[model samples]
Target: MTNETEVDVIDPVAQIESYTKKDFQLTRLPYDFLYGLRNNKFQYSQMQVVMADKASKEGVKSFKQLYKDYLATYHSDEQMLAVNYTEFDGQPFQLACGSYICHDDIALLNSNGIVEEICNHPVLPCVRLVNIDDNTEKLIIKYRKGYKWREITVDKEILASASKITSLAKYGIAVNSENAKGLVKYLTDIEDLNYNEIEEKNSVSRLGWINNHGFSPYVDGLVFDGEENFRTLFNSVKIKGQIENWIEIIKPIRAEKNICSRIMLAASFASVLVNPCDCLPFFVHLWGGTEAGKTVALMLATSVWADPTMGAYIRTFNSTAVAQELTASFVNSLPLVYDELQILKDKKSFDDMIYKLCEGIGRDRGAKNGGVQKIATWKNCILTSGEFPISSEKSGGGAVNRIIEIDCKDKKIFTNPSELVSEIKQNYGCAGAIFVKWLQQGDNIETVKHLRKDFYKKLVADSDVTDKQAMSASLILTADKLINEIFFNDDILLSVSEMQSILTTRASVDQNRRCYEFINDFVAVNYNKFNPEKDGYNGEIYGTVIEDRIYFIKSKFDAVLQENGFNAKAFLSWAVENKVAFTAEGRSSLTKRICGKVCRCVCVLSVEETAEDQLLNNEDLPFD
Candidate 1:
């Protein structure tokens, strides 16, 4: 036998004389090791093995656990052990046969300590599981990867798989074949321990009210359960800087009387009011030339609720339509925002985005197993910005009510926008949650409802506001009033007269008239694509110009219009009625022999004739 000093779990060096007095040996090695570890007289997990003989093997059962074999060796049954197998009452001290370790035990080498002594295995770094999500169907393990902790949700059956064991290496829990069964046993044994301490609230994937409970993920009686990679979605809706700092930087923005700044901020708040106010989703588009501060204004609006930096609360137009829908659903009642509309390659894609983002529901997709996947839906205002207008002349007339196009004006909205960007990024995520909390307090939600109604009534009665336009406008104004009262303490309020400039009338958004204007613009830009001037040119011909009349090829004209989401036949009808397109003998189109073939074309007045006609119709028209 050899002498080995046992290290105390707490005071490692304090008990040097006590170990020297004992003269402990290798007999009953399993029992002594287990007892010493359980009693805190030794450290097993971090111990170094200095000596070995005959190659130690792992023991599944304790030496004292062979009770039946001990009795069988003797003729008669005895009080406990027929032969004394362990040091303490023929049993391992402080070792309970219950499902798991007792709460009161101060143990280093768990599970009898026999395995470590026999196999020379270090004690497993026991995992500290946090019951974050309340799903009994699965087990969620929260483990430390160095200093920071991460979560992995897994089914109970797959807890000790090879992949899972490898995944746990980063979590600091070292496991091998000899100790794999021990780790699994430890986890399953403690699954129900301290059951009452675990919070039993369900997890949520969206931002707004989870149920009648009225708890947002931001407020955190609930855990965020978005896709594992989308942790930023939940993290974005958090408070970083103090609320006072947010208010201080944001107050002057409201006071500036800048339409884009004020309206974008209000729109951020208005998304939450969509449910309470019983209104539909709409778009607030801020567009202008370069350096007009469109994206900066978007960031200011986004800061009202979240981090205003790109890819944080604000997304770009680089994502696909399906990805955007998923993002919308995740944001839920929060304002769904995007910057740099120019990332989208074409006009048709933007038009399609308009309908999809405003639809309030995601596409019904099928699951891999069959049936349908969970349908994602939301109520939110969509905020967007770009170098050009969101809605062009060819946009759907219905899209008019669904969107509010604000020109960023001729000059830059902010002379020094980068300074504002730096401030907002650091001092955001304060107001959005507070605004929601303020509304939920007492009769405040009801108050907002009434404000929306009052504004809508006044907007339609006094001004030429369409119902949809009035609805969106009223919500924004009401939001403006709420935030002003909460922060600015009632500064120079944005009046209805000033706000009315943003609403587009039915005449302006009329699809037919827009289509007619689109054709005129198209012809002017592509004049070189037409003929006569460039005869025998090998470039693809769009039309043939004969004197003042340009005959656009019917196929080419229809295809281009359709590609741009315009109704070509409807545009032709309106163009003929307006005398912009010339028809032969009251027919819809004319047949002309061009390029050595009989071809059908829409013979239209040149751009000069169309402009001169418009000048003649207006008495107040100015001549340049």
Candidate 2:
């Protein structure tokens, strides 16, 4: 009996093999026909709705119109026929001729069979379809910079890939997999094929990709050597029944297609943080109630990374070295997990440092010199939690867009986390193997999207939510990359309130403030970084944190009251006047109110003493 449900599995080649040698004729369909059919299937029909939405956006319309306008302007330039550009092969090619207003008898430009070549291919039909506009004449001629134009239908896919590739390439990661998309499509077409086998094979291949792109291992203390030993450690366990359960947790029942999830697992395996430059300052947030597995999710993510031994460093209410170390480590990779950040007293300076490290320009000189001599301005992802969003007092500049958030709501610990960890390591082959499979599956992450969206919907429906800091920074970054890859052209409105609400719910107000005071003390000890440009000025930098009124750090303000100098009490008074409230701890009651008020005394400015005056009137006072 012939089973119609059976999927035809073939080698990498796009050939349809029979179930049995006697099942069908040896050569009924031509190879080229099968190959083209596989490439141009309607399997992505579900994706078309999204594609049409993107094409209908206002910015997309503007882009198309702009190109049309540019082309129309060229039509009037009689002197020019068309513009010319070189192909990838470096051959001179003429673009639409332009107006040679200054000088030129004939249009002295080389014209290849480019125009005819373009009118007949995917670049014209499928790729260029995205350039569709209400005005057809203006739309067709606007995009004139290519030997082969992409088809609109397929162009959407290619453009999405191109944009992602370009963004990554800027950071020096080039993907030369010409048929990578086609290959993925073909492989996925096989039904009933063991997905695990495919995932493992692909995971290994993705690891090699990291090394190929010049990303060295041990970024931020995480190491990924692509060692066979680690691979064995990952594949030792089994996910047999758990797969179906996990799939159920992902809402919508059906997984959405996206590229971010693929990269997450793959990059995690390679121990390479996928920093998509196009989405600068990506924001990832974990929000939900307590015991929701937010921390566990972060741990899982970190463990899967190439190396988790030094993947993070936890700081306390008063730790200077930890802050410096985190700032310096961000340059290469690894997330700076600021645990229990809500317990500190000072928040201003601490938040300022975090903001800059997350989004501001690269660290100051010597920032990357991770040793004692290093400066503090390197980039990094910060993970923390409290009851509210980190405020400006605790935030240096602003929350970087690169920050990603995840929700760990309702996550229970019925299963032993250690056991799960062991199982993952032994059976799944760890990050290197898992991620390789994800990458081999190509950049499709509809599954993750559906999961996230379902979670969001559930939260909207529920009222008893807790643990707002359930999401991890990595989760947000992964989401952003996926959104960009899947809905690059879609005009979706994002709510700032949603972002702020989630962040505020996680940060601690007092602990965040104390972080500021610590920075102030460090600067006081090392004053060269903030010396005033004046003489006879005695002002000490005051660091204080407000209570639940605000979360996170504010800024470093100067206290002008000069007492026993460095008076903690008097400084607190000044803070009150400026609306900054904080308590001084571990100081004498008298000093507590005027802490470190004077950093430099007026007498520090010694004008050159006149020799004659000093000789006649100067007398050394004997010390008691």
Candidate 3:
């Protein structure tokens, strides 16, 4: 036999070639040969045959056993095989390395696999494996570090290239290292894994699992047996509360004499369940004086679904319309509660927000890759509170009609508002779940639709409420009636009479009514200026009281329109069409002799005309 030093000096590749010429049953070289040749390590190559021959003489059962023996002799202790065991579907399995990730049959292996079908593990945890229709697959890895999640999709064949591995490492992942080697070995050894092909489907807007039939993980009441696909994936959180405790605490408030507050809370709960009903999503605003418990009413409504705290379920109106749209999209079918509309002091922003939210869809955008971004959409109720009504001089008929303004009658709707708030704080979110449970017991969609339609027709016939305004009231009525029957055992009913009173009164003061009211109030406040006898110095009587007709100077009338945020030309045209004001020549401004002076003015015929004709003209306005 040659000396050990001389054997180390021998060319292992030449020796292997000579041995292949002999009658040896070796079909191919071992996997370690490429590594040894790259490292210029003749020692590892020299030991391969000795280890294989020794294993064969010792009656090794398989090539894996021989490979293990070779690793034990040459590799260090840290490089030795380390196995971890886990069970999937009640089947025992072992993961021989740490870097490998096997989710079913598809294993993402490291660069050491030296195979065409393997892919390097991504740096980030987010990975999308898509199997196309042509029997080919694509792996897209999104890296979320300092910036937003960015995508890098590649084919399976590119995984074996050194340049591909280097490029991936630049984005961050270890390649050709000890960790990669172990990962390769572990992935290659997994046995009998089952994997289902991932097919592309329509993306859900919310960040949780949902089925095709609208059954969602976030939704409380749903019973269907089908696989849920997480189009916009998110982890579920464990909520802590007892539904029984909540129902008991909320019973008194629900049974209280404040029908507006009770209806607001019930309608908020019913909003989530009304997705199956064919009606547009609408808003409810609790409006009253400073101490009228409007905030408490909004809190009661918010307590149905989540914490009534400042930022939990009840959010401030200090954000932009874009932010509101995003929040609505994030919550999806849940109720969105906004408190203190006074915080949104920007009149234009507030007006835009009201219109955009009632529209029920977000603005379309373009993605970075030049494709149209997924549009965000939601259908849900928006509950708001303010010291004054939501429909103001700046609001149009469309915005006014979409909201049901419930005026809180009393300064204190609850005897102990603090206790009610505390009870709700501890026991919130359960009533919403209970409401959902009751809704899921049977199909109530047709009943809800019928009740809404019937109520809509009744309100339209009984009063001057617009169709959209009547629709909002109808939803509230349906919710209150259903909730009283289901949860309250029909003990208290939010009667159609009460709703009729509230809606008719609220509808009577819509945009035109408010505008007319604003004109009267302005005239009353500036009566001294309009009266030539009171002020003593007058070039032309701006607003002169002549007999019964109140004549307003055209310039002063336009100034009032500008001060009240009404479009001057549009209001003038509207006033002319409605006969609220008229000119001598049927124009906006007309020269007339008022109190012995020629002046350009718009003549208000009577105070009653402003109120009556404005309503008639506003009868066909669309509030959708």
Candidate 4:
């Protein structure tokens, strides 16, 4: 039935023998041949003859009838043949079906072995099934297009192969009609089940999911798991000097016994979660003095998310605009930690940008025209420093309502953080594990509310005006959350009590003055009285009314007099020299009269006023 191959004499024999060895056994057919089999109609004479002969032997009227009979014969019982298929590279053998075959067995094979690899079936083809060690229950399947034999123990797919085989036979091509249907169905079923499992496994993979810069989709060279214990997460301490003091800084905050304080903290966290993106964009203002371990606490906060590189830390004085631009690329990660935010100029422009970047939708102007383009909505968190709670430009809106404050200054008052940071750095991984566990234990909003309530209960006695203000905001934000938690109640909309509580508290006059220093400067340089076209007061000119000899000094007197060529210095000198009811205190009062009289003189005798005087006195202009 097969031809024997000579080891050396015949040139054709040597070539054929080498080709038949292991490498070319299943691969002798060219790639184009397989391609043709898959894409072209299967109507070749060779397949028709085989089907005709099989049909005649079985006394069937058609090829379809013969295939049905073949399948019926092997429907209940089937045997799996064990074979080692190998590929040869010059002389070295690559494992094929599971091992090496002698040269003698290679020569006896006809038309090569294993036709499935070269077949074009809609269903995934199998090359060989190996027992794979003592585990005969799990078979190693070498699929047609796959790189290696996969181990499988499921039989649901194997049991459903009968129908698929019958369908393939009607079209042509050679098939072991006896077992093709059962084999094809089993393979298909297994593939579907296997894919579903893979998807589920990958869904819960949290590695590199949380970070400081934002949320990274992928991270390298890091081990992540929420279950790791504390002892295993840290490293050995180099106990000495400032390094010894770092751990001391973190102790009190870490060992907080009051549940209310943590609830407030959780409520702060929930404010962000109310609209948290995968990136978690939110800002937390942690204001305090030095040695408070504010920096160390920030580091601990990041540990909960795992990986410091995921977050970026910048001092308050840095250009916030540039900071926003740089972090834009990584917004999908986690929170952007703005350290020492107090250094930024307390102006509306700078603060507003930060405000919008935190809770408002970030937007930019289009390059060609000034078209408004909204940036991708990100959930990045914000952390900054300030002595007092900042007010939002648009108060009472949900955006500003989400911000929560923590009084870290009080807790870290006497504590030293030098040693705590050293310990935390060494055991960063351990800290992260603990933080994750803490988050999973309760509803985050409720947890934060408790913290805030307990904190106020403790400080109700000596709380300063600043603390009271921040507490009120926290309470309002909490009440909003509680309203949602308890189901929307009609009481939320009926009263001005909530609004009055937040609006009534005014900052101290000294504090207000300091707070608006930047705004006042902006106003002074650019303020103006109403200009119909310009929509506000024209700040450039001091308002002046000119009529006859008296002038109404609505604004800058010096500039107004000088523009009229009145020899403002000479007039002041004359008024003083003549003692014409004039005094240093009377200058403004007299100036107003001088401006008003000049205005009236121009109205009654327009020809008497010079061109410069007409231009200088806008009060007489018809447009005014």
Best-fitting candidate, scored by lDDT: 1
By summed lDDT, which 10 consecutive residues of candidate 4 come out lowest? 598-607
Which candidate order results from sorting by lDDT in descending order?
Answer: 1, 3, 4, 2
Superposition error at 189 for model 4 (Å): 20
| Cα shift from native, residue 21, model 3 (Å) | 32
C-alpha displacement of 1 in model 3, angstroms?
15
Off-target runs (Cα >4 Å) in candidate 1 are 1-138, 142-151, 154-202, 415-419, 462-465, 519-557, 569-624
Error of 3 at 71 (Å): 13
> Which model, 3 or 4, shows the larger TM-score?
3
Off by over 4 Å in 3: 1-211, 218-239, 287-299, 307-309, 417-419, 425-428, 437-442, 504-510, 528-556, 584-586, 593-600, 606-624
Off by over 4 Å in 4: 1-249, 253-294, 300-304, 307-335, 340-348, 364-381, 386-415, 429-504, 507-624
Root-mean-square deviation of Cα positions for candidate 4 versus the true structure, in angstroms: 19.8
Per-residue lDDT over 131-160 for candidate 3, one digit per residue giving the tens place of the 0 to 100 score: 221234334444333333354654433443
* Per-residue C-alpha lDDT of model 4 across residues 559-606, encoded as one tens digit per residue: 544443233344445334433213335342332233124311111111
The TM-scores of all predictions, comma-separated, are 0.67, 0.29, 0.63, 0.36
- Screening candidate 1 with a backbone cut-off below 3 angstroms (N, C-alpha, C), the clashing residue pairs are none
Global CA lDDT of candidate 4, please?
Answer: 0.34
Cα-based lDDT at residue 379, candidate 1: 85
Best by TM-score: 1
Clashing pairs in 3: none
Residue-by-residue lDDT tens digits, candidate 1, 22-124: 1223233322332333232234211211111101222222322332222233213222211112122211122222222221111112233221211111121
TM-score, candidate 4, is 0.36
lDDT of 3: 0.57
Q: How close is candidate 2 to the true structure, as a TM-score?
A: 0.29
